[model samples]
Target chain A: MKKTKKVRQEELKKTIEDSPFITDEELAKRFGVSIQTIRLDRMEMSIPELRERIKSVATQEWNETVKALPIEEVIGEVVDLELDERAISILDIKPEHVFSRNNIARGHHLFAQANSLAVAVINDELALTARSSIQFSRQVKLGERVVAKAAVKGEDERGQTIVQVQSFVENEEVFSGTFHMYRSNQ
Target chain B: MKKTKKVRQEELKKTIEDSPFITDEELAKRFGVSIQTIRLDRMEMSIPELRERIKSVATQEWNETVKALPIEEVIGEVVDLELDERAISILDIKPEHVFSRNNIARGHHLFAQANSLAVAVINDELALTARSSIQFSRQVKLGERVVAKAAVKGEDERGQTIVQVQSFVENEEVFSGTFHMYRSNQ
Candidate 1:
């Protein structure tokens, strides 16, 4: 059965609202329409691209991070988030993040992104960073997008989940940290 | 022989500028004047109390920190800072540091205060946090002043200076961390 244009557009809005990370091509496939038609529908509805939606979601989580978009081409937009297994997030360094003289992003901002992601990966009602060992090999400048990859490396003797996160700029490694997260007992 | 009033006031301002942590009683004794006279001079010169000055100094280091002064009477303002030995700093959580629903301070702010102090205690031209292991024993609320004390715990096998920072809300321990700091050879 073919749906009317008005009904399809309404459903499109609802779908995007429910899953902000859906790409335009995927939406077009889902709606059984041409890619160009999906683009036009998005433009008419004033809905931003997939990238904008991901940034907005991150901003709601942490007010200060990711107001600055990826100024360059996104190599990949893969956010692999699996509870108690692995999680990933992207942060672009904006003017606010860098020093006025150096344009170098502050170390704490980098740490915060990794630390919060470590907590997010835990399968618990509440999770906190028990301890973390972090190292900054290279300085991240403004406008660089940092992709943080966190993997759970099994539990320790204390039953704390050990999460290791490594952040990279494009392909170059920028920062790495290991977080021992405390999870609430179910 | 007695110094002129103008000369004494000029020296008082310079003394406070050089050592911001000096007490009013110490200033009075040093200038050979009554404490009341010192107070009057401070009032006339529009110089704030020692507490205000410490907050202002902390604010300069990180713009978002310590603007919210300690609301209650300070138990101790002991910032026992010795380069390459130990250093201490205080941070008061304010509106920006807390959640609207629950006025609990965010975990990352606590980490920043401790991490920055860990970096500051090193006697190098440039030092950074290579790694850290931190724990939050208790939740810190808004308006709570966290006193972070960092002490040098010698060097690791990797030649990294190990600094341990313990933060307290009054007498109760709130957070503690051990940081491996990277120091530049000067």
Candidate 2:
């Protein structure tokens, strides 16, 4: 009887796959079962709860053309890294990595690329960025290669671990940034 | 004779406008002048000196794009502003401002937006971020509005002003951050 019910639920779900509004009541009625039963089946199938399902469909319809816009060039490459005194990877930046018009890389991109590399170095189940700050010196030009050397700065008063990163383009210090990533509950 | 030479210089500049690679020696020979004269013309036009100019052009062509792509809806709107003693701004998060399936705002956007607002509120002609640290309490969700409040925490040893910011969603504190931005010489 249990197997039979599972098969019925799967069939009903497929039938309503095209429906913008799939409700527990509708599925229950179609399968001649209580709404609770249909809800259990939905959960077992990993279907989002009603509110999330609604949001997903609405977001899809509202932003069909603009989902997951790809970023072409990731600014800095990881050449060295470290976490909590553990060396992980290192990053390098070349003159070809900077903006030509101003010779300064866009601040946010530099931060993001460096932060992403920092996150990548962490070997945790989940790591979330908490904060970051950066400083830029003189202009970095083409043909000059920069290195991003990082180290764990310190744990803050609130227990956030501060990571310091510096980028040197062809021996000239071009950029430096720091990031904080939160480690989830152990 | 002076008028003729001026017209010839204009023509040469126009030719190089399309192809900046036109060498000073080539321009001087073509215009019946010394290389020094062509170099002077280039300098007067505010073009980078030869070595720097080549580097600039090549860098622009190569680093054609190093953009900071915004991850969808990971930040909220500024709802309040206070620019005394410490620059501050309050922000609220909407449901769409979440990053992952768990409905938490990405940590980086939260800090970036708050830090940018604080720096802007400084009303200084030039300001650049220097360093920061932050911590997170809990995850934030969609449809739950958040409040981002900021203040200047203190100055670092290097004299950079550090600002503290916190974001609360649904009366529950979600994120808190500190930022440092440098005041430029007027």
Candidate 3:
């Protein structure tokens, strides 16, 4: 038997909420309804399209995982993060991130990428950096992608947890830092 | 005697370049022209208004002082910087920088402010961080203005320059860091 419109729309809402990246065509097939009906149902329900929905869900998930800070504050797009273990992020250098005179990437941008990844890898309610030792091994240019990796390196006698961060442009190391973090137990 | 239109416009451009924050009304008074005429001249020259002009000049000056990196890469607006000496920047956390559920400022934003400031204080064509020790003293809230100060602490025997950075929110210290930098003279 065909489902009623109200019941179908409710199921549609639940499906989209569960998998926000599902396309309209896929939804139409799943619901045994026309693409127009799916679009109409979405419009009536005030649900955005797949792209917007995916972005919203991704942002929310990122916020949840990043207990120490807001995800938007991260210098780069974090692709993976395992609390108290390892994390990875990627930064794409744009024209604005290069010196107009030299077309070279700024040193601080690399540091921001590494430092933020270091902070993000910690599993704590509040993680604070107490100290770091860092080095820039190479110069990065505009239009390059810098990948940053961060790993937790255990704690010290003073109860300070250490995180190591390294950034690379392609296969070459660009920057690295070791951050000592203070975590607040809640 | 009144100046020619061409000469007057040229003078106006020069004056604005010298003081980007000057108002159109001030320009009119100085040039003995109506505010409308000043606006027209600015329009013809494709010069933006006072606010845009100030932002442009400030960004350009900040870029020039930061030889090791691009100004756009800085996490905040760097208002002042002296090579191998001291630098200052301001970051105004926005709604997007906080978690939607809670309006707390992200930790990475604070780290970016301090880390970038540390790199900006170095006097070199190419500078990179080797290590750093950082601390977050307090939680920063949304819409807060973070002011970061960076000072050079001289170089070690191995030619690594040390920079110290402290970030404050309304005079309360929120974050602090020490950076070791490597400079390439060539």
Candidate 4:
């Protein structure tokens, strides 16, 4: 039985959404189609490759308002962001992020994601850190996904923009930070 | 000419201060003495070995009050601590801490040291981080020593202890934070 292109594309979209990390080769094998056909279907459906798919979900138009760190250089993938207001990012802990013995993700990686997200939220051409206070509530182990949310809380006496970020692994809060950012414009 | 014991000890202390990272082997070569002699002189003057000296210069007693994480587990070496009031820690970035291509130390290593020091400060059995605000003033590179100082501020309305931490690399400030901590007693 031959599945039509319309049905195949819809099924492909559903499969990719269910497992965003699934590779093209695996998708081709599952669908019983040539790899070239899978690639063509993905292109026609406006779906990105595996790498981009992981970063593209739940994300706003990222490049326009973000001006601080280059998108590639940002610690985590920015999923949602609004200039001078709020932002959100997600990081998946990989083997490189953990201690070889404990498999616990290093604390600094959590901080970097939170810190970088805060900076991107209020980003000017350059945003220097003035100060911050943070706490690690729980340790994130390898394979945990950390979602960091940043909110701009008014200004301090020095006119530094205060951005607060909280990171969660599932429903549990793992880390949180409040950043005093010195924006080039502000 | 053989140097007197007093002169040798004085020069050794001065040398260690001038270059905190200088090894005893180097010092032995400079003074034309055995490594044992250099060790004896350092002990006589109450000067710690090269590793300890780097952390001990501006520190208070460390082992007494810290209760959050084990002493060895603390990210940076806790140099000065006065449990609940203030604490200080130092970390020297090595090869493992930096990006292989750039030698730029990961932001999380700095944050880990700062976060651990803050946790150790209140440290009543266990202290959880409720929130924090932070800023990174500069990028820390491999081989740079970071000195982190944590000060416990007053409690917030919710009874969370507010702690501020600032990390410096030499005379330049690299990172700072104001941490809101949920202490067990509070």
Write one digit per residue (lDDT tens) for candidate 1, span A1-186. Answer: 898888988999999888776677778899999999888888999998866765564423332221112212112233555667766678879986664445767677888778777766676756666667777878899988777877889998888889998987754679998888776772
Q: Write the per-residue lDDT of candidate 4 for residues B116-151, one digit (tens) a residue.
A: 788788858656666666667888888887878889
Model 4 per-residue lDDT at A184: 73
Per-residue accuracy of model 3 over A40-156 as CA lDDT, tens digit each: 999999999854553454322443386676687678988767788777787889976665657777665676788777777777756656666667777788977777878888887
Choose the strongest candidate by lDDT: 4
- lDDT score of residue B65 within candidate 2: 17
Error of 2 at A146 (Å): 6.3
Please give me the total number of clashing residue pairs in predicted model 4. Answer: 19
Give TM per candidate: 0.56, 0.43, 0.53, 0.54
Native-to-model Cα distance after best TM-score fit, residue B112 in candidate 3, in Å: 3.6
Off by over 4 Å in 2: A1-107, A129-164, A174-186, B1-76, B82-103, B142-144, B152-162
Query: Which of the numbered candidates is closest to the native, going by highest DockQ?
Result: 4
Candidate 4: TM-score, chain B only: 0.69
| Per-prediction DockQ | 0.19, 0.14, 0.23, 0.33
Candidate 4 per-residue lDDT, tens place, A36-148, comes to 99999999999898657645643566555677765666788887778888887889999977755467776667878987788778758666566777777887889878878
- Candidate 3 local Cα displacement, residue B42, angstroms: 37
Q: DockQ score for model 2, please?
A: 0.14
TM-score between model 1 and native: 0.56
Clashes of each: 4, 16, 19, 19
Native-to-model Cα distance after best TM-score fit, residue B98 in candidate 2, in Å: 5.2
TM-score of chain B of each: 0.59, 0.50, 0.63, 0.69
What interface RMSD does each of the candidate structures achieve?
7.2, 6.3, 3.9, 4.5
